[model samples]
Target chain A: MQQQVDIGEVVLHHAADAYSFGIDPYFLLEWHAWEFMQLGPFNLTPTKHVIFMVIAALLVFLTMRVAGQKLQQQRANENAPKGFANAVEAMVLFVRNDVAIANIGQDGAKFAPFIMTLFFFILYMNLMGLIPFGATATGNLGVTAGLAIMAFVVIEISGVVKLGPVGYMRTIFPSIPGLSGPGAVAMSLFMAPIELLGKMVKPFALCVRLFGNMTAGHFVILSMMGIIFLFGHLTFWNWAIGISVATLILGIMMLEIFVATLQAYVFALLTAVFIGLMQHEH
Target chain B: MLLALLQEAETHGPNSPFEPEFGLIFWTLAVFAVLYWVLQKYAWPAIVGATEERERKIARQLEEAERMNAESQAALDEHKRLLAGAKEDARALIGEAKTVAEKEREGLLAKTRQEQEQILERAKREIEAELGKAIAELRRGAVDLSLAAASRLIDANLDDAANRKLVVEYLDSLEHSR
Candidate 1:
């Protein structure tokens, strides 16, 4: 019973209203739908993660929209981009040149917009999580899975579109060149399911990797802070926990920031590669 | 109400970490799709197009600048070539003028020397003829004096006019026969 209570308290403290300093923005927002306007039949309540996701989405939209306008207005000039425009443009170019072109080849230009969208969107969502009041949407498995699903769809579609359905199937199951008749047939049949599962594994890895990294980092930070609460009665122990673990927590927070950026990059990079790999066999 | 719902969500399952909520997935997909569509439609093309256009423009400008530089260099080279040709032509003209001047000086010297020589020869011939005339005049004067003396010695008492006339006629006949 004590263990259960401790676990519950820790979960509530970490995942619920963190710090209780009113820094938890979720508590500030009203969750009740006025009258009969519930979201779904499954009693789906809009969580803080959803709100943060929307905020991230809006941020991406507004930035790109403004940058797009700036780009349009300055179309004729030969000067470099400046300020916020410059920053966004650098990221866009990075995704286009390094990520998209390097992976997708000549046909990469067609998908630059989509790849750019993915990179900036993921980057914004990741970075938002590091803020005081913000929660990482990507920390949620459902969100990461959704993102992975989108990437998976793009990869599969590009593969199917570039290589016909027959060719796409052949990508999964290859016939041995020298083997004739039943042997090659048996080999292909044997490899088909495995190859299909291999395709699914890419997105699954992306989902789990992002979710795990983000969740683990936040948990470590929360757990480190929980140490002070764990030894609240012992003043010396609380001071020691505060002094020692506080530094480590700060370091980990910095690391979390880095991981946020890195995971975003990884997600975007992998998405580009997956899409590119589908289009080109090599 | 929101806090109550959140508390409900927080306690729905202790293993909430592993739970994949359909609502969140649907919302994420919906939100991301909308964002992607808005960006792709209104933002990306413009941003990317402008950037590419700017890049191409810069490349073209660089190429233009390079081409202009090359053309200017060629022009300078041509100018240098023309100047060199002009310098060569001037040198040749100076050489030709020097040679012509040298020929003219030589011709003038030769002509002046020939004129001097002709003048000296004419002066020499005139001097010789004058000297010969003077000597002949002196000889004639001496012969006339000697003739008078001889005539005086031969016939002091004789008729002077008749004797001189005879002598003169005799000398003239002798000169004619000789």
Candidate 2:
């Protein structure tokens, strides 16, 4: 049976270049505070909290890298991975093989660096959304779209690289360029827009997809919490029953773990596919 | 959707950073650089180094132990084979010596017995020669005595030849009867 969990809305503002509220693109872009700005326009916008996340990201990168480094030691190959490093390599290889390389290709290994990075990055960002007083960087479209744009750039550049100067346009369309039967022209015209739309929609789709999912989960959790307060004013019975919302909220919290990993995976997988598409034909 | 969302957001308020254009670009570049630099420099290397080092060390140790074990087992097997060979060699040597000693003893015994038989046979031959010489001498003595006795009994001038013949006949008769 499917469980219906309803979540409410999150208000985001675009009022200023340097908005201070959470979950807003304006704020994310404007994140640097005055103190951090003194260093030649470098963003000092990350709050101590954002700084914490930065720190967390750093730790993740370091931990994984160190593990990878040790694993790479030449003689170590004889023994194979062990302990924590074993576990970590297994995870990395699994993700690389099953999701990235499988969907992508051999050249896809290079993108493993990007995909793995994004997976952890987005995963942490999504998880950070749940923490009280924690900023969900993912809630902002600027961040998500920025990520999506990176994918777009990589994908387009990769496609161009794969198809080359003369063949690129041809690869995008089904028909030969000069042949113009009325049906052919019509078909090309129709397909061209659809192809254009498809290309344009990819990043936008990714942006909205990730943004909706992350934001929705948070809102659902928040709404469940709001229920207690929403009903708290009415009756003793309402207050008591509303307390049960805590359990449901906890349940959602658990579900958030699954959602977080899944979103991170989908995002990374899509990135690989996008990157892979550059080198590969339909 | 971002544009639409922004347009809707525009309805909410008069905004300063009105567009995502340069704002996102600048921040993304900034954030990515900073994160990459900091992580690659201070954080990533260390953590990756540690984990990889750990994995490598564990792997190395396992390999070392395995190699050592194999070497030891090989040495043990060699030693056992050597020991067995040595034992077999010792037994063979002992058996060989025993055969050699038995052949020597038989040869020595046969040599001594042959020498003893030769000495006894020579002594018997010498004694037999001496006895034969003694018997001849006795016969000469007997002839002299008999000649003296016959001369006294003959009464002087009887013919020596006749006496000699009588003596000879008597000797011959005695020999036949004996």
Candidate 3:
């Protein structure tokens, strides 16, 4: 009996990233956030989320690299595409044709790599959460924020590069004809902050939407687990509740699979759209 | 003061799920950067390039097929035109042969008519010459017979004057009354 209780506690400890191990003192920062030993001055602590993120990244990289090689070879041999190479090529075409090019127009090819990387990275991260004993790195606010920051940087830089500095500034702060020095200055001052806030809001939406969606799915799955524990004490009701809970959890898991891919597509697509908006001045 | 407060917050726990951690964000950015770099270098270019190339090649092939189809259609039309012309030429050739045959038949008819006319004229001339020769011979024979009869009457023993007179009278009567 005591051994089962200990095992349950250990399982819960590993499941929640926000919680510490074994409910010892709940050392908030020290344990809640993953911590590891340092070499010299740099802290290189590999958290569960970070580890999964790396795995997802590696999975995406290796699969795509292999698929890329096969596709190139397929071209050289003039053979019909088949198998994993065929599947990955379809996805690559969809990302390029439907998502990237559809949103970004002619210059879409230039940003195809970045958008494809973002898409596959998020997709793998979302799918990783569904695996046994796997945690979703995208569920982490910090990670999503980081991704959003990267998108934001790309958006801003491409805007400047596509439209020269003056053109980009004019898009943000338009000049009105027949307005003298004072009025022009006043209008520019007024619109500049709003435009800046608008630019920041797009990435903020990307971050919160991805983080909230991923976290919600995980939270529901965890809550379902919690229900099983809540009914554990009542032996009579436990079995009945366990069956229902398991069914409900299975349904949510299926829904999460769809949500995961949808969220990843949304993130990448919106990033492309935002970048495209900046690429052309109205 | 802000740095000191951040240090203090670090010592404690995150205020909420919204709380951002330096290490997590830094690592996320670092990892994503590496992913982007690696993918940008190898995966993206190859995949996009291959897909575009395939699409372009397919379009080119389709265009070539369409052009070939059009050329074949033109060739078929030309063949049909040639066939129709050949049929027309055969019809004209048959008509020309019929006219030529008709002219030859007419010429043969006219030549046969002319030859019949020439043969009739020659037969008439040959019959006329043969009839004239027969009339001349018959006349000569009749005169010889008459002279012989006259000589026989005189030798039958009458006076020469009386016989001569009788014969002369008879000859004159035959001449007058005969």
Residue lDDT tens for model 3, B19-106: 5555567778889999999988888777778667777799899999999999999999999999999999999999999999999999
Task: Quote model 1's TM-score.
Answer: 0.65
Candidate 1, CAPRI quality class derived from DockQ: incorrect
Residue-level lDDT tens digits of model 2 in B1-178: 4566456556543221233333443455456556655545553433345444665799899999999999999999999999999999999999999999999999999999999999999999999999999977886677667787767765577677777777778877988999
* Candidate 2 C-alpha lDDT tens digits along A104-183: 78776556556666677777877776665565666655567777887787788778777786556755565746777887
TM-score of each: 0.65, 0.55, 0.63
- Looking at candidate 2 chain A, the ten consecutive residues that score lowest on lDDT are A7-16
RMSD (Å) of each candidate, 1 decimal: 11.7, 13.8, 12.6
The prediction achieving the highest DockQ against the true structure is 1
Q: How well is candidate 3 docked (DockQ)?
A: 0.18
* Model 2 residue B30 distance off true place after TM-score fit, in angstroms: 3.8
**Which numbered prediction scores highest in lDDT against the true structure?**
3
The list of candidate 3 runs beyond 4 A from truth reads: A1-44, A176-184, B1-17, B54-178
Q: Residue by residue across B109-130, what tens digits does model 1's lDDT show?
A: 9999999999999999999999
- Candidate 3 versus truth, CA RMSD in Å, comes to 12.6
All candidates in order of TM-score, best leading: 1, 3, 2
Q: Is candidate 2 or candidate 3 better by DockQ?
A: 3
Under the 3 Å rule for N, CA and C atoms, how many clashes does model 3 have?
0
